[model samples]
Target chain A: MMSARICDKIATAIAWLAAIVILGVLASFLLYMLYKGLPVLSWHFITGMPSDIRAGGGVGPELFNSFYILVLSMLFSFPVALGAGIYLAEYAGTGRVTELIRLSTESLATVPSIVLGLFGMIVFINYLGLGISILSGALTLTLLNIPVLVRVTEESFRAVPSYYREASLALGATKWQTIWRVVLPNALPGLITGITLTAGRAMGETAILIFTAGTTVSRQAGDFDLFAAGETLAVHLWYVMGIGLVPDRMEIANGIGALLIITILIFNLAFTIPGRMLQKRMTGTRQ
Target chain B: MSATIIDHHRLKLMYDRYVRYLLFACAFLMTFIILSIVIFVGQQGLVTFTEVSPGDFFFNAKWDPSEGQFGAMSFIAGSLLATLLAVGFGAPLGLTGAVFMAKIAPPWLREIMRPATDLYVAIPSVVYGFIGLTIMVPFIRNYLHGNTGFGLLATSIILAVMILPTIISISEDAIRAVPGSLEEASLALGATRWQTVRRVLLPAAMPGILTAIVLAMARAVGETMAVQMVIGNTPQLAKSLFMPTSTLTSEIVIEMGNTPFGSAWGNSLFLMALVLLLISLLMIVAIRRLGRGSVV
Candidate 1:
């Protein structure tokens, strides 16, 4: 039988191999997506109207609707998530009610996106008579955003050194004043990082939007009507390849795939990196 | 001026008392939403049994909405097979990668891999589907001698790639959470690094690794766009991995739009979604049990 030393060397080599393979896969995937998609991208492609049967089509409306819906969903989810987070971190007692609330959020996070889509369909679209509109889509997407936001908010609030709270209370400050003046300011950096990461994920969400958003953009470019069908870039990527009738659907799909990767990279470099640095700086000084 | 200042102070005091209730309502809204999802999805899914029996819905392989035969067995089986295959391919790679990250790699390499895994998670499902469609499907058809290259094999490979981040990050945390003193003790005992990991670390970290695998499985089962794009989405039980098949998720994505609301066809699709929901919830419960077992 081989000695343990020999086995140890082999396992170490294998672990190195595993790490290399992962990085290699990721590098190739990103490079290939950019290589296939970059040449097709132009100003017109980003802003031009989609053609139904023609060769030349742009994803202007789809891109517009993506941002529009993202902003709306964030608008709806952020406040509630903030409130919930504050409660859990500050006010919650270790009781059955708190446990139930935690369980609900955890289960909500795990619920399949498609199941949430169906629920959105029944309640937001069918029951509420909203039809397949941006409003309905935004409301459904809120459910997807809530759990992540709540978790982030709670973590951020808890990270504020408890002494900060104690010091404020030691003064004549009320509970509300202590939270608003001390805790919220200190937790801002972590909150921003969480929100940025969540927004990045939300921008790429397709399944929930596909059902409620109805896979069709308004005829008018940059339409702001909440009732208009909102087909975001991710959904457009799927729809174009799967069911679109355009002659150049392959090119459109390639462009969309590449565009999405570029956006994700930008989000990471532009927001997440800075956000992380700010968070580190804040904690370093405070702690 | 004195009266106004007193009124402002009183108003602030009242706001503090009421704000707690507001936050409580916001937190309670989550529970309300979960209950609503179960009630709404379950209510519609239950309608499937009104026309078709439970056994027929669960066990029958033949699924034809127009013919009034609503058999969901094929889709159910396809989901299980695909999830199993994905976990088989993904878990070992992820665990080893975690080992490398947690115990093997230097700090610099670990930093790079951290962002790389996040990037993997941030990539959307539809893009994964697109890659599988344009690259893997064609490559499989040509190289593997598969007829279409769009089936369980292709779907599982894509899913394996998609779930790598989830498995790797969780397993790495589990390994890292193993007390540093355990490593010191093993080394002092003259055990090799691999032996220490194999005998001591693996047993200690087993619960966490299992939790990671189960969560990955949940993700694979619920995955829709990626699988639907590559799986060819036929409603049949495939004889081979290369043959076209549909999972509950893929089938719902394909047919939900075409069926009118409240019809047998539409309700059946909701039932498929309900299956996906219950499976994920079950995985969460299993993870909780694993956590409890580890403490003992």
Candidate 2:
């Protein structure tokens, strides 16, 4: 009974306005954090050690730990996740086991990282006596990363055209060769996007490492021992701010926060820009 | 030539078998990890019930660790209250944005907005916590005039921001999933865009949207560092938005380092984490059910 013309106009305008507000909020969160933190962010801040009483604190070890843990976790998880992907996409045609795997993946995805942190604390640290080491943290993170990589790789592999599989098989190439030479290359973009997303997640992760990785920022410089308890930048920020001891805690938190934001931005841009380009070429679709 | 063909076939068979074995091993590992976590957390947490009464742990409002009490009701109340407030405020904004993104935005706007949402997700939760701690908590304290700026209100706002990208993306997908012909049918009958969305698309996407809301709630409840920073980690019932409170996650994180490795406090933290794990899995199952229902 209402006049559709006026109704459409008003609704369209409202939706557009709402879109603008959401966009503004998203943009401002990024811009404000960057603006506030960038002034104090520097190479020294990136590579220096904390003073006893906050005169000149640096996140050198935390930064090193973050990258070190990320690399360690990735190295361990990559094979497992990639192999899971291969199975799910190439071999998991239809069965209860495949369904079970999918369920496990979904369930694992939603398991709170904090809980995973606790699991690492109890199992790896307490029982196995890994003793708050980076290896324990890495193993905990591998549990987080494996499900993500499996799903992404599976999805990417499934996205490849069935005809390509047929063509490769028709040419007498075995299934392994076809998967390696043809399907794997085609699925590279999704795999890359997944890896980047996982990397961002692992770098930004704090709750999982809260107990599993010790919060101590190593004072002894250039020590890259995996067995030692080390804090990543995210955990470092939380610990620094939580302690509330130093006069320059705010400055340290701000610098590290900006760096965290920048790494995330880079990871995101890496995923999207390449993802978009590869997707376009694969689909032969114009933007 | 015959010998070479036989040799190639044998090699191919071995390679195929080896690759499949590796892949299957990887697949099995996924299930193994999930089972291991359940077992480990169960072993750590389930033993504590003998010492701490379930009624005391679950129902008592006070959560003083020094007093030898491990009541988590206050934390539960805080998490639920914060999630309720966050969903209340965040859902409308996210759905509206999703409506615009899916149904109204021009291609250029969609391009810009999509990346913005992605960027929103990529921002670390700790950064959100830092910004909230420095800006939001203080603003509330100064303007609202609280002794401690950190409280449930600030925590809710930070949570709302943290969950926005999830809600928007999920709701957008749900909205876009609506069959175009259905929209056209409504439009041809002279219903406005709003009416089509309200009476047709929204109804159709309700299950998906519900899943999105629940997902956001799950994410909000599990959030640790951000809420811990702003909410002051006070173990009290959430009497008001301005009051400080604790959550299962924040409580564990705070005590994880200080507590002895296998003390009663450590076991209690494990129990708290068990509660979190169960809640998340339940939400995921509910989401799957809703997803399945919509298809039918």
* lDDT of candidate model 2 versus the reference: 0.84
Query: What DockQ does each candidate score versus the true complex, computed on alpha carbons?
Result: 0.60, 0.62
Model 2, A1-287: lDDT tens digits are 55767887898888888898888887787888888789988889888886647557788888889989998999998888899988988998678888777777777878888999988887888789998888898888888788878877887898888999999999988899999999999888778877887788779899999788878755687567778887889998888788747788888888888889888888888555887698778867643
Q: A65-136, model 1: which lDDT tens digit per residue?
A: 988999999999999999999999999999989988887887888887888999999999999999899999
User: Compared with the true structure, what per-residue lDDT tens digits does model 1 show for residues B90-162?
Assistant: 9999999999999999989998899898888888899999999999999999999998999999999999998
Please give the range of 10 consecutive residues that has the lowest summed lDDT in model 2 chain A.
Answer: A278-287
- Report clash pairs, candidate 1: none
For model 2, the stretches where C-alpha displacement exceeds 4 angstroms are A1-3, B145-147, B292-296
Could you say which candidate leads in lDDT?
Answer: 1
lDDT for position A198 in model 1? 84
How good is the docking of model 2, by CAPRI class?
medium
